[model samples]
Target chain A: MTRSPFTNPYVLILPGFLLSAFIILWPLFQLGNISLSEVNRFGQIRGFAGFENYLAVFNDPDFYGALWRTLIWTFGIVIGSIGTALPIAIVLHEDFYGRGLARVIIMLPWAVSLTMTAIVWRWALSGESGMLNSALMGLGLIDTNIQWLAQSSTAFPMQILIGILVTVPFTVTIFLGGLSSIPDDLYEAARLEGANPFQLFARITLPLIRPFLNIAIVLNTIYVFNSFPIIWATTQGGPANSTDILVTYLYKLGFRFGKLGEASALSIMMFALLLFFTLIYVVLAMRGEKE
Target chain B: MKRTWLLSVAGAALLSLNATAQADTLRVTVAEYSSKTGPYFEEAATAFEAANPETDVQIEVVPWDVLLQKLTTDISGGANADLSIIGTRWLIDFVDQGIAAPFDSYMSDEFNDRFFPTFLSPSVMDDKTYGLPIAASARAMYYNKDLFEQAGISQVPNTWEDLAAAAEKIAALGDDVYGYGMQGKEIETDVYFYYAFWAYGGNLIDADGTSGLDSEAGYQAAKLYKSMIDGGLTQPGVTSNTREDVQNLFKRGKVGMMITAPFLSSQIATEAPELSYGVAAIPEGPSGARGTYGVTDSMIMFENSEVKETAWKFLDMLFEAEWRSKFTGGEGFLPVNKAVAAEPAFADNADLKAFAAVLPDARFAPVIPGWEEIAAATSDALQTIYLGDGEVEATLDGAAEKIDRILGN
Candidate 1:
């Protein structure tokens, strides 16, 4: 009584399914449960609290502000990085001198740890004695130094800028890979048919790389949506909660404030938002694939 | 051969059991000292183990910022240490959660009386002591003598007006030098605000347990800070500077005054010996009263500690006169024990004496649940005010309302 491999596809995927269930589903279920109940500081579940946690989150102005900021942070970084990366990737895709070295240099920010990048950028952008301030002052661009991370008006923009800077390298690599995967014969045929560079790009290049572009946008959106260390290390979502995004606020609620139930509700909200974006992306990708 | 091997295996197991039965190991965790090796905890452990040869003391040092998270994780995972040093404010939370054991049974009244009542109050809830204060610190004004001389100020400022005048004089010296370095960021933001708020006779909570930041003193404190920033007595972009950044500015002789703790004295001694400075009680406010913030850390025993007696013995050893003096002196912290306070090592030091003078006047933040969130709210309000985002009165009022809500009022 030997069993064939096709006897059960579920069994074939059993290990991966279990791993995902343990790593992802269990904590998520626990989070959902905790979100719906009242929890004390010691992680004890105190009876069910209905939709109280969710109501508290919805009623809180900070949560609303953070949700808006989280959207701005996510889209700003995702679009900024990919938009910048496409040009750099196109440039890098050319047969130029020192292309390998250039590629590595551009990818260095992605290689370095996010925390290190944040700390370095923090020092560089510091108010009184930062390198950026010093350079700006020396260059006579401004008479006074700007407190980049300290002022609300500047902090969020600076965070987004730093987020894009660190995000661009990886995005560039993805775009470069996508560019490389496009058959050069198509471009050669287009050029022979007297198609200009714009036509070559609009028709052959983009269509061919549509799958990679979808992946780049969707993954970047998710990554930037959940980014924490950069914002936490830089501002801790402050100057007045001006730079706070959803994840940092969730951390403050859960760990700092010990409002685990509310924090869990916020986490579920963030999860749903990201999930919504992911579903839309998946559907669009599938439709494009069918076409 | 199999029987012989089995007998040898059993003999080995018995030998291991005998080894385990010989000595008891008490695990302890302490907040990190300035040094990476945590010499204070190491020395205490060595001395404790020396006294009790039959017991082994295993000590772990964790940084203050991560201590609570680590302890909570350990407690949840059922791997907590026998004893650990925690912030005094956290004592109530730990006791309420049943994570910390009441020390009243292990401690005598005389032993408990050894600590200053102000320092010991936070460790007690409902008249049951749960921890013992090991180290304490209070904020004080530090002035750069060189800058003071350059500004032609002969004495440390005694009143808030005089301090402002001195700041003006210091700023008059020009060349990128500022008079006062305000900490407008992070943890110290609200603390700096409190220093002024208390100086002006403001309180966070009133006798009736209501938000007190809407009082006149609160408005005065905010106005004073705003005036200092707007009058050009403080550096541009003061809102960007943290306590450490401001201290560094003072150390570089670029700033004239800062209100910080005794820790800065040692930092200056090590980092900027060339800079001459003097420590004084913070300037009196318009109310003619001086006040500063104080913070304390306590050593607490866990409820589930298996070696409770051994752990208490080790803690008792740490509180002995000689060991207590050594620990406090080594860490540059104010002593919790009165006898340790009278020791020549602390009394003879100029900086320590200055801080000690203000010890009685120092006030601790209210030890209650949700105080962290309250502090953060206050810090946010202060930051907003400092950055000129909102009116001082409006900001303070908004913060008070928010805090009242947080306090469930």
Candidate 2:
């Protein structure tokens, strides 16, 4: 038997690996270079600044506020969506009337453009003329309107809720795929052994879908951490920069304020933070599987 | 052999592109102000092309919000158009970077005389003209006439005290109706605050080149707005409503008064024609000092452009009285051209006259390198004050320190 050269793993993977490396590493390198240099407003690098940009980012009080909010934004949306989507996926997995329609409806929001959805939500959440206020008033929920986006106390929470709302569609799809891959025979055998519904979920469904669940969490954390439109389209991180997450803050720093050097530094730091979190999660999940 | 064929094909494409470049194509990046803006420029380009048979005018319309970002990327890539419409406030940065070329050599005395100096001078730096004012506007107070009549206030408020009184009366009328529409979010939030800041005799920059926000004028102006917000004179949730949100309330007759740009008048014209509203001067403070915010968008020639002469001719055609008047009227801009200002459509317009009346007191955003950062700092402080999260004096003082740092004072 003659072995083909292309059958070797290194030979098979080399081109694909290089293509992905160029696609990803080139911008990462540019960002790192810009972060270490004195970049003008037009992104033209002037001279080496030797970590000055990162130092400025560290010194800014607004950057600290944004960093803190970014954590809350990422966790609040990721946890909330995963929690909501799990039950939803389990329910849809069961045979029910209009099941196909339910699946389509569940996935519908993912089809709409995020920015368009956010803009519509902005109008609906208005203080005076908003449909939300009118609906709440009609239901006798409150005597007066709630200015939802007026203060960070209210606005940030509302923004988190919006993030979770938009994030559920994608998370649920992942869960559904995981649920379908779990053999029905395993659940039937668990029931034959007189396992309860909760036991079935815990032993059969939970263990089987653990990998997908972890993947959903890691991806959602990254997406929600960097989500811009929900907060930007609504409040623009205003009312005193109170609701700014890192991405929105980075945008204002780079584009609005034209502090490209600091923005690049902040971007690199955010990328590192996301990378660290994902790496820890993946390694822990892999170790758990190994054990 | 294949590589040679590919190289020849690439060379032929490049040669063809160069030949087309010599065909006198003048590219202009226009900022879209309204739905009408693109068509207006396209029409002007068509006319310019007809007049100069050798020249082909290309219009690339960009939205106002992303114009600067687009220009920055385009410039960094060396792919910018020959001309672009930019905020006059941004001209200082462009000039400092040598991105924009001075048009002084292109401007004859008569050509220079065509523009109102108040409109044109904002784009001038270091004794050179860097931009031509393509659109100009100033802010004025718009009041609901029916609300004033219902409140039994027949006269326009010329001072803050009178405005407060009128607002109080108007607020007493109903629960849903708000007396004053104050914008505390998004673009121009600081400028909205500056209406009172300047009224209280504040200068954006003091003689020592420090920010004037920590002075008595700043405290008083902030106090006035805080009091209005606290007393329920403004709409509930002052920090939530953007300029457009407040303007929407005004159009619906829910807001008694709003201070906004001349564009709002045109917005009201089409959106709420039946709503009887009157434009008036922004009310003054106790010292009787008053000012209105003047904003201009300028058409500038890029320093990198190879077709400056053709771009200048297209600009000359754009600034001609007929086109200028048409553009001004269609977009509800205050005319930048002297002849366009004399046209009956603008001269006979009462709302524009009120905006024109404040020409002497019009304060363009000061030309500084970090003006955007300074504006952001001011806006954040104002928002804090409006939300009652921080004391007015302390917030303004903190903002002043921040701005001074940006100014390198």
Candidate 3:
């Protein structure tokens, strides 16, 4: 007897299931196991130590500091990116001069390599001999050159600014796609009802782009939370751990300090935090859709 | 078509078999220096291959920042090289993990006595020698003579007080030049701090494995550096500058003096030849003790290597007096071999001679399992002190407590 392709869905999905098991589930299981054990410098498992690594991470002050910093870093980038992108996306959606060229120019930051962006920003922000400093001084904006990446206060803000700069282009592209998907009939009807630009935007554009905004904010939060190269290349989370996020701190624990077990524990915490946020967002979006 | 395909397959198999039979290839990895081609290793490899026709040496150059990570991955994945140059501080960990093979069985008394005692100490763990030192460096104060002359400094600073006075004098020149350049960033921040710490008679760990950072010597060292930053003797953004940045500043004739290793000599020659510079021993502290931070890299053989004898033969060829001299001199590193130091090339170079003078008094950081973490913690503490985030003594005490916990005390 001949069988249809969908007769046994499990059989058809076996390859994908096996691939996910091998690539994702297996490593996650290993990470969970490692988080509960004692791992030495040589990557050797020195027997299991139940809850020891977790307790250590919980009590560590650096971990708490990194948690707080990660929140600030994540929120700052997500909010700043969306805030900047929404306006630009609206403008770009309108018919304007050099709109194609403007889109390309706006997306350039997203196209450049992150490491290259970091290095270029570092050079420009250098205190002693930087183009930014030279231009500022030339314009009589400040009496003395400031070390943007060297000071604790400025370092975190500068990194956040760069994060926002790199994130906005992608956010704008997504918003533009979302804007295009909104039918022009709704906008025309609102305009024909004598709706102002702001009123039309508030009633039509805002409600229509909620899904895109949700995705952009959640994804950008995850991306910025896990970002490493920008902080590592710029300040190394330094000038006294002022800018350290969870991932860079995890890196120090695992690679620099050779504490795999502790690093694994920290990794699980990071994953749990991100997953919790993701689940809440998903649930909220689903509920909204149901309403 | 069937005959042609079979003949081609057979030919490829025969050629591969013949290639394998002709040469026993040994894989060697070395840390990358500033030189793009790694001329020292290339020259040594070529000479060793010439001397041992049956053995082929494949050299892999890795940058220092990622060398340990690469080696760790390779060892875990069972793809470790037959022989590799590793930082001496990592020797004990490698030995403990059973990844490195002891060299005692292969060494003769004459051959064993070739290395300087100080340079050889880090490779010996529990009286079992696991590696041989290939390159060594000692930190010293490098001063730009033109900057000093412009500041009207005739004599090099001799004491911490003298150094501070000289720095103030240089800073007074006032063309945006810093008097002292401190490396507050990664790679060797702890080492730079130790230059002052050791000179002040401080130690990282005592006999009982307790941290000594809270001692008066440590406080004094931290305070001295803090005072330098506060007094404007250092660059404005001292916390952000790495050793490389400070080196660039000095090369640009903007900094008066920086404490760095001898490797900077070659860099200065190539990057800033017109800039005149002088090398001198670091200033003595108030305690009347002088110290220089010594770092060494050694060639280690892996326990899993199949071609052990061929690897040993290649090592022997590379360590011959002539080749060793050329390797050290060409790379601008201090020699591990006694005969290499006597070579005219090193002896004639004034900067090399200056660095050589301080080798006898050089001291290495403690070779322990968690020393890297300790160094990082200490660097953070020093940066905090420099930035005036906390009181020096309290911050150092806090760092010492953290270190003690890391030491499992």
How much lDDT does each candidate structure score? 0.86, 0.92, 0.87
What does candidate 1's lDDT look like per residue over A183-258, in tens digits? 8999999899999999998998788878888889999998899999888888888888988999999988887787
In TM-score terms, candidate 2 sits at 0.97
Which digits, one per residue and each the tens of the lDDT, describe model 1 over residues B141-192? 9999989998899989998889999999999999589998898878768889
Residues A109-139, candidate 2: write the lDDT tens digits: 9999999999988888899988999999999
Which candidate number maximizes lDDT? 2
lDDT for position B48 in model 3? 78
What total of clashing residue pairs does each candidate reach? 0, 0, 0
Q: How does each model score on TM-score?
A: 0.94, 0.97, 0.94
* Best-to-worst ranking by lDDT: 2, 3, 1
Segments in model 1 whose C-alpha atoms lie over 4 Å from true places:
A1-6, B1-25, B37-58, B109-117
> Candidate 3 on B1-409: residue-level lDDT in tens?
9999999999999989867775588899999866743777887788777877877788999988778878876875588899999889888788887889988888889888788888888789899889898888998899988888988999999888889889999999995888999888777888888888888998889777889999999999999999999999998888888898889999998899899989899988888999988999999988689889888888999999998988888888778788787777667789888888777777688888888788777888788788888888898898888888999999999999999998888
Please compute DockQ, using alpha carbons, for every candidate against the native two-chain complex. Answer: 0.57, 0.85, 0.56
Residue range with the least summed lDDT across 10 consecutive positions in model 1 chain B: B33-42
Q: Is the docking of candidate 1 incorrect, acceptable, medium or high quality?
A: medium
Measured over the true interface residues after superposition, the C-alpha RMSD of each candidate is: 1.4, 0.9, 1.4
Q: Can you write out model 2's per-residue Cα lDDT over B247-327, one digit (the tens) per residue?
A: 999999998999988988898889999999999999998899999999999999999899999998888888999999999
Q: Which stretches of candidate 3 lie above 4 Å from their native place?
A: A1-6, B1-25, B37-57
